[model samples]
Target: MAGHTSKRTVGALPDTTAESPFVPVALTWLAWVLFAASVAALAVRVLFGGDWAIPGVVAVDGLTVLMWVVVTFFSGIVHSYSRRYVAGTAHETRFFVLVFGFTVTVMGLVAADHLALFGLLWLSMGLLMAKLIGLARGWRQARAAARVARRHFAASSGLLAVALAALWWETGATTVSGIAAAADTPGGSVWLVAAGALVLAAMIQSALIPFHTWLLSSMTAPTPASALMHAGFVNAGGILLTRFAPVVTVDSALMLAVVAVGGASAIGGKLLKSVRTDIKAKLGCSTVGQMGFMIMQVGLGFFGAAITHLILHGFYKAYQFLSSGERVEHTAPDGGTGATIGRVASVGGVVVTLLTGLAGGALFAVLTGKGLRVDSGLLLTFFVAFTTLHAARDAVQQTSLPAAARYAAVPVAFLPAIVVYAVVYEGVSALLTVEPVSTELTVLHVVIAAVFVGIYVGIETGVHENSRRLYVALLNAGQPSSDTVMTATEEYNEY
Candidate 1:
C-alpha cells in the first residue's frame, strides 16, 4: 500500500495517471507566448502611454498598464508551469483551454472602462475560476467544491452589478472614470447604497472573514490553478477598491466602516491560521490575512500602498504555492543546533528589536515623508515599524547562533529590507500619481488601531490555547465544507 500510494506532491492527487497519452500542451505554450507579448507591449505603453481612453470603453493609463503587466506576467508563469503539472491528466486539454481564455478575460477586465464590459469580464472571471477548481471531472468532491465557489461568485457579481448600475444611474456616468469623477455629487441614499454594495463585493472576492469559506473550500483545485487563483484572481478586490477609491472616501462613515471590517478580517485571519493543519489551508488563511491588510490599506486612503502590497504579495505567494511540495518534513525537527533559547537571553533580544524597529521607521519616514501627522500615513508607519520589529524578533530568537550574534543579526537583516521596501513603495506611489481621497485620522481610527494591538497581544500571550472554545472555533472556522475532503484513498485514486 505504501509503495503504490500516489505521491502527495504537486497535482497528482486530482486525477488518475494515464499510459502515455501524448499530452498536447501547445495551447498552454501559446498562452504563455501571448502573455509574454502582452507584458512587453504593456511595459512600452506604460512608458509612452500618457493617459488615453477609447471613450468609455478601455483606458490606457498607469493603472491599466501596470495591472495588465501584472496579470499577464503571473498568468504566463502559471501557464508555463501547468504544462508539467497537468501532464497526461484526463482533462488536460480542457484545463489549458480554460486557462488561456481566463488569461485574456482578466487582461480585458483590468483595461475595461465601461460598466458593462467590466461587469461581463468580472462574471467570466468567476465562472472560469470555478471550472478550474472542478478540473477533476470524475471527482465528486472537486465538483462540489466548484459548485460552492460558483454560487459565491455569482452573488459577488450580482452585488457588483447593483453597485455599478446604481453609480451609473445616480451619477449619470457611463464609464468608471466618469463615475469616479462625479463621486462628490450629493446623490444622498443612492451613493451610500452603491458604495456599500461595492465594499461587500470586494469583501467577497477577497475572501475576508465570513465570506472566506469559498477560498477555504477551493483546495480541491490543482496546484497550478491554486497558484493563479491565489497570486492573481483573489487580489481583484484590492484592485477594485483602488480603482474606486473616490466613491469609498466620499462618506467618512463608510470609509471608517471599511477600516473596521478590514481590521477584523486581518486580525481574525491571523488567529485562524494557527489552527489549520493542511499546508494549502494555512496558505489560504494567510491569503485571507493578506487581503485583509490590503483592504485595510485602502480604507486608510493609501491606494498606492495597497497596490504595492498586492503586487509584491502576488510574487511572494506564487513562489509559495508553486514550491509548496518542498515543504514536507519528517516528524522530528532537523537541521539546527537542536537547542532552544533560554528566557533570560530573550530580554536583550527585545531591546535590539525595539532599536532596529525605531531606526527602520525613521528611515521610512525620511524616505517617504509619511509619519509626521495623525493621519493614515502615521498608522502605516506604525505598521511598518511593528512588522519590522516582529521579523527582527524571529531572527534574534534563532538558537543556532550565539546570543551576541543573534542579537547583532537584527540590524544586519532589517536595514536592507526596510530600505528596499521603502524604495519600492515610493516607486509605486509615484507611478500611480493619484493622491488619497481622504487622510483624516479620526478618534474611531485610533480606537480601531488599539483594538488591533490588543488582538496581537492576546495572540502572543497564548490566550487562545488557554481557551478550548476559542481554539476549536478557530479550527472549525478555517475548515472547508464537509464534502470537500477526500477521506479514503479509493475515493481519489479510482482508476
Candidate 2:
C-alpha cells in the first residue's frame, strides 16, 4: 500500500511540471507585445516631431511615449519575475490576469488627453488595484487591506471627478492641451477653487500623512502587486500635477498649501520609517516620504525635477519590492558605532559636501551649456549636497584609518556620487519639455529648507534623545496589532 501511494505521488509531479511553464509563456508574450508597441510609438513621435491625437480625447506625445516605455518595461520585468515567485500558487492564472489588466489600465491612463477620459481611466485603475489587493482571498489580512484601499480610493475618485468637472466647466475645454492653453488667461475664483480641488485630490491619491493608512495596510498583498502599486499607481499624483502645471502654478495659496502638506508628510513619514521592523511596511513608509518630496518639488515650481524624480523613483521602488525576497545582512544596527560623528567632524563633513556639490554642479552646467536656474538647479544642488554629507559622515565614522587619511578620503570618496547625479539630472532635463518656472528664493522657501536641514542634523546627532517618548510614539504609529480594526467588518467578503 505504501509503494502504491508513492507511485501515485510520483505520477502527479509530472502534471504539475507540465502546467508550470504555460502561464509564464503567455504573460511574457503579452509583455513583449506592449513593449514593442511602445517602442514603435516613440519612434514615430521622435522622427515625426508631432503628436498623434485621437481628436480631443487621447494624444500620444513625447511625455506619453516616455511614460509608456517606463510602464511597459517595468510591467514586463515584474510579470516575468512573478512567474517564479508564485509558481506553485493555487490562483497563479488569476494573478497574471489581474496584473496584466492593471498594466493595461495604467498605460491607458498615461495616454489619456481629455479630462473626461483621464478621469475615467484613473477611476478604473483604482478599481483594478482594489481587485489586485484582494487577490489572496484566503488571507484575512489581504481582505482587510483591500477593503481599506477601496474606501480610500473611492474617496479619491470622487474628488478627482469633482476637480475635472470644475476644470472642464471653467475652461470650456475637455482636452488637457486646450485647458492648459486657456489657463494662461486665468479665471477668477472658479479657477482657484478648481486648483484647490485638484490639490486635495492629489493629496489623497498620493497617500500623504493623514491619508497614508491605506498604503501601510496594503503590505498584506503579494509582492508583485505591491511593487506595481508603489512603483506605478502612487505616482499618479505627480502626473496630475505635471499635467496641469500651467494652471496649478498660478495659484500661490494653493502652492503654499501643497508645500506645507508635503513637508509635514515627508518629515512624518521618515520618522515612521525609522522605527519599522517589517520590510514591506518600511518600504511603504519610504514611498510616502519620496512622494512627499516629489510633491514638494511641484509646489516649489520645479516641474522638470518632479517629473525626473517620479520616473527614477518608479524604477527604484519596483526593483526594491521585486528583489525584497533575498536576505541581506543589516549594515546599520541600532546603537551601532556609526550612528553619530563628533560635532566638529559633522560640521566639516557638511562643508566638504557643499563644496563638492557646488563644483559638480558648475561642471555639469559647463558641459551641458545650460546655465544654472535658481529654482530647479539650486534645489538639485542642495539635494546632492545633503546626500553627500550623509555619505561623508558615515565614511568618516566607519573607517579604521588615521584621522588625517579619513578626513582626506571623505570628499574624494563622495565626489563621484555628486557628479553622477548632476550628469543624470542634466540629461533628463534636456529630454523634458516643461521648463522650470522662474521664481526668486522667497523667505518662506529658505525657512523651509533650513528646517529640513535642522531635522536631518538633529536626527543624525541624537537630538531626539530629549524627546524619546515622542520619537517612540511616531515609530509605533502604523504597525498593526490585534486590537487594530483594519476594516468595519472583522472579515471582508468582497473576494
Candidate 3:
C-alpha cells in the first residue's frame, strides 16, 4: 500500500514537459495588426467625413485612437513579459488565447460606435477578466482575489445596464452618436446626469477607488493579468470619459461629478499606497491615483492633458509589472546600492517639499493677482498643500542622484502649462467679469500639475519599501487566510 501510494503521488506531480499554450507572440502580432486597422479607420474617418454624421466620426476616431495606441502598447508589454515570466507554465498557450480574446474585445469596445455595442463588449471583457482572475495559481490568496474581482464585475455590469437604460429612455436611440446628440440638445440635463452616473460605473470597471478594491484583489492573478488589467484594460475608464467629453460639457453638474470622483480617488489611492506592502498592490493603487488624475483633467476641460497623462502612466505601470518578475520587486534602475526608504520618507521628505511647494504656490498666487476669487483661493490653497506634500514624499524616496536630479524639473516643466492656463483663464475672466480669473486659481492648476510631476519623478528615481508593504495590505485587506482556502478546498474535495 505504501509503495502504491508513493507511485500515485509521483504520478500526480505537475507536468513540466509542456509549455504554456498562451505565449503572447502570436497574440502580440495579431493585436498589432488590429491596432493598425484601428488607426487606419481613424484616418479614414478624418479624411472622409463628408457623408458621416458628426457623432459617428468622433466616436470612431476617439475609440480607434484609444485602441491603436493604449491597447496595442499594453498588449505588447504583457506579451513580452509573459515570455520570460510564464515560460515553462503549461497554460502559456491558454493564457495567450485568453489575452488575445480579451484584447480583441477591448478593441471592439473602443471601436464600437453604438451604445449597445459598447455595453456588450464591456460586459464580455468583464467576464473574461473575472475568469482570468480565477485562473491564478500558487496562493490561496489568488482564489479570494478572484472572488473580489467577480463582485466588481457584477457591479460594473449593473451600472452599465442602468446607463444604457437611461440612454435609451432619453434619446430613443442606442447608438453612441444618437446619445451624444440627445445629451447635447437643450433640456437633456436629466438624461445626461443619469448617463454621467453610469460613466461612474465604467470608472469602477477601470478601478477607481472604492470600486478599486477589486484591482488590489486581482494581484493574485498571473503577472500577465497584472500588466494588462491594471495597465491596459484599466484605461477603459479614461477612454469612456474621452468618448463622452462632448456630452460632459453639456451639463455642468456632470462635469463636476467627474471631477469630484477623480480628485477623491487620486488622493485616496495615493494615501492608501503609502501603507500597502504588496508590490502589485502598490502599482495597482498608483494606477487608481493616475486614473483619478486623468478623470480630474477631463473634469477641468483639459482632455488633451488627460490623454497625455494616461498614455505615459499606462506604459510605465505595464513596464513595472512586466520587468519586476514574480517577486514584484521595485528596484531602482541604476546598478548602485539602493536603500529602502519605506514610510519614513514621508516624515523626512516634508520639509524640502513644503518649501518648494510654498514657493511654487506663491508664484501662482502672484499670477492670479486681482483675479483671485474666493473659489480660486480655495483651489489654490488646496493645490499648494497637496503638491508640497507630494514633493516632500518624493524627495525622501529618491534612490539615486539621477532620480533626485529629475525632481528639479517639476517647476520648469509646469511653467508653460501654468502660463497657458493663466492666459486662457484670465482672458475668460476679463471677458466675463462676473468670474474674473484669480491668480490663486491659476496657481492651483499649476500646483496640481507640479505635484503630479514631483510624485512621478520620485517614483521613477527610487522606490519605497512601504509601497510593497502597503500593496500587500491592500491586496489581502479583507480576504481569507491560506488556511481558510485549504479547508474550503478540502471540504469541497478539490485537490
- Provide the lDDT at 424 for model 3: 45
Q: In candidate 3, where is summed lDDT lowest over 10 consecutive residues?
A: 431-440
What ranges in model 3 sit over 4 Å off?
A: 1-25, 35-59, 137-141, 186-193, 326-495
lDDT per residue for candidate 3 within 324-438, as digits (tens), equals 5566554645665443333324433445565556555555557655224454344534453455555555554566655446356544544454555445444323321022112
Q: Name the regions of candidate 2 deviating beyond 4 angstroms.
A: 1-18, 21-24, 328-377, 391-420, 430-433, 480-495
Candidate topping lDDT: 1
* Candidate numbers, best lDDT first, in rank order: 1, 2, 3
TM, every model: 0.91, 0.85, 0.68
Off by over 4 Å in 1: 1-24, 332-345, 493-495
Residues 1-495, model 1: lDDT tens digits: 334677576543433233423333556566667767767766676576567679979876677777777877887788777766776666877877787788889888888999999999999999999999988878888988999899999998999999999998898888888887896674889988888988999999999989999999998898988998999899999888877777888787888888889989998888888777678988999899989888988888888888988998999999999999888553554566322212224679889988988888888888888777768788888877877876787787688979898887779889888889989887777667467654788899899989998987677656666778887788888888888888986787311
Cα shift from native, residue 185, model 3 (Å): 2.1
What are the Cα lDDT values of the candidates? 0.82, 0.74, 0.61
Superposed Cα RMSD, model 3: 9.3
Q: Model 3 compared with the native: what TM-score?
A: 0.68
Once model 2 is optimally superposed onto the true structure by TM-score, how far is the C-alpha of residue 259 displaced, in angstroms? 2.5
Ranking by TM-score: 1, 2, 3
